[model samples]
Target: MHRSLCLAALLSLAASSALASGFPVTVRSCDRDVTFEAAPKRAVSQDINLTEMMLALDLTGQMAGYSGISGWYKMDDELKARLGDLPELAPQQPTKEVLLGADADFLFAGWNYGMKVGGEVTPDTLEPFGIKVYALTESCIHIMKKDKSSMEDMYTDIVNLGRIFGVEEKALALVDGYKAEIAKAIAAVPADAPVPKVFVYDSGEDKPFTAGRYAMPTALIEAAGGKNIMDDVETSWTTVGWEGVIERNPDVVVIVDYGDVTAEQKADFMRKNPAFKDIPAVKNNRFVVLPYAQATPGPRNVEAVKTLAGAFHPTVN
Candidate 1:
């Protein structure tokens, strides 16, 4: 009887061990490959979009907190609810002190989002502090020579995050869902539908700040059956002369709603400006407002693409 009881205990222990997570998983981040011995217990994600990536993975339990969200971007009710009780460590960008103080084991940041090139808070600087930084794939253009941004870049980040957190199934499922949802949404547009020429109006009175081919919006616009007017600019995000805007003559202007200025205000500015009077988008009063979170790469991109598709093909859906 004693031997049987001991054998049963050993079997139970072995079963538990078998079910344990496989550690030391290696994931590619930008040009470097990183290995994680175990899932991060305390991770800090930077920016609203990056934080949403972590949240979409149901990784709130692993997060220490988030940074660079509430600073420039307005938090939506849905996002706020998902991040309940999670502290906003930094209003803008995080300092090395903040990560070290939180005892953060990992950081999810990008080039322009959180860590700038040679900036104070970068992957190299944070490495010595025991904080492993996962670079946002879209922002890799700052450091590495890469192809133009694609929806696949976002999917890659989601899958890699899942692998790092031991939730591969959930990540892949979410990506599949996004792809299906986008396909269904754009199905309303006819195959021979004219591809609308779109312009992304972020901000700037002197020169318009817009996204180029390297930015996520290029892919989003393409997925929505529209072409970005600035796709040939070779920049991710930069200012362009109004002459270029007049020359391109975008059919629809996608307004990014964020900061102090309202989307309506931006539209009003475009309509009032004499220089933009002849522009197709402004002349026709065709404008679609996309929330900042939705415009950038993250979970909200699928919905953003749907919004653009509906706007670009007005009669389709």
Candidate 2:
């Protein structure tokens, strides 16, 4: 009995020592290096896209709750089912109070998606509350210089998240699956077919807000054998005059489906407007509506590539 008790005590002591040491993880969030001595006990992610990232890693058990979901867009049944009992802390951008209330030690979000540039709920603001921030790789452009958005950016986020949460194997597997699926989808496209010119119409009537060269949709369009007509915009999502749309005369117009305005309404506006009458897409009535979840950078991007590939190359599959 004495020996058994001593063994238990020694094992307990060793575990206590290991716990004290913790797992020191260092990852690059934007231009800065943020390190965590241990995996966060409670994490909060903003926006459906970022939330989906965490869900992909099966990290709901590590999360306190999610924010910035139902307020902007309807939470789909699949996401709701996945969430199960996980609560929505805030319908929109979660404040410091919400984070503190839930005792969230980490936040997985990006600029504009949740924490704005120099906004109230930025990394600096949350630092005082002991909440570490992991900025989305694609949104790094908002703060620092970055090469245009690519599949690699999303993959980097997944890999880093896995590292942070001790799920590197799952992350690597997911990324590999994405890479294989994407390559297969792209390979099936006809080499002889002309690449379609795709105009991403996110929203706006007077001046159309569209995806630019640095946006994930640009990469999505490229992968699907199409070109973003506004690839020269120099920024991610931005506003450009209708004159440019008319000037470009894209072969297909992709509508971003979200917010108060329906995709059909946005399409109707373009179709009825005199300014867009001569536009090739308008004349040809070739408009594809992509859901907000799929259009943005996330795991859904892989499925989006397949969808866009089908639209861009009707002859293939």
Candidate 3:
């Protein structure tokens, strides 16, 4: 009986160690402990960017619910079909009752802005109800009070998600492919050649919203071998006067293409604006329309870089 008791005690110790090994590590944005109960069999993604990452990681089978549909970055038809059975959580700011009632084991979201700034659901708010939350690193910067964001940080986010979902090997493979493509594109550009000045016109038709220094679009412009004309602007989003755009005369105008607005419509809108008609890009028809997903800093950003590189240097082949 003594020997049996000793064996049982040893077994219990080993079990505790194993459980400790499986406990989720605290991430950058939130204060709460994010340990998963059992790898989240039923998960709900609060943001479309998070949903996209799950799809990329091939963890869509575990997805129990999602927010945002039929927008610029709509899920694939097959994925959309699966979502019909899942609960509909609002993309912008889902209520606590709505989130809790979904009965999800885990909640995945891109940023804390919706929960933190809006006074909606939070890490502490969800923990009591038995839900674990994971915030993507791309959106963490918004909550962090950091002055600068980086491309390396974006790559780290992909690898981190891959680690969480047990798809590190696949994530590395994807990263390898992306690196190869970017290197090839970069090699073709001449070092002495001048980088074209670019203006990223993201959404907001009323004020002509433009990408400032801190925004993801500016990072993408630099990565794609172009110069952001408004890199001097410190804020993320700024309303520039039409006279300013005409004076800058950027070589390439990148319009954030939404599902509701077509590329031609955007071009026409710019052409009609009296202050923009004389700009070289508008006059010469050098307009590149970037989708909403590509413009944002997330897993798809590398693809956005590729698109921009192709647009800027068409002769690269």
Between the candidate structures 2 and 3, which one is better when assessed by lDDT?
A: 2
Off by over 4 Å in 1: 1-20
Global fold similarity of model 2 (TM-score): 0.93
State the local distance difference test value for candidate 2: 0.90
- Give the per-residue lDDT digits (tens) of candidate 3, residues 239-269: 8876677778899999986656676788888
TM-score of 1: 0.93
Candidate 3 colliding pairs: none
Cα lDDT of model 2 by residue, 1-317, tens digit: 69999999998997787566545778999988999878888999999999999999999999999999899875889889999999999999998899999999999999888888878899999999899999998888888889987889899999999989878789999999999999999999988889889999999987989998788899999999999999988888889998888888899999999888999999999999988888888899999888898888799999999999998888887
TM-score for every candidate vs. truth? Answer: 0.93, 0.93, 0.82
Query: Model 2 off-target regions past 4 Å?
Result: 1-22
- Pick the winner on TM-score between candidates 2 and 3: 2
Model 1, residue pairs in steric clash? none
How high is the CA lDDT of each candidate model? 0.90, 0.90, 0.69
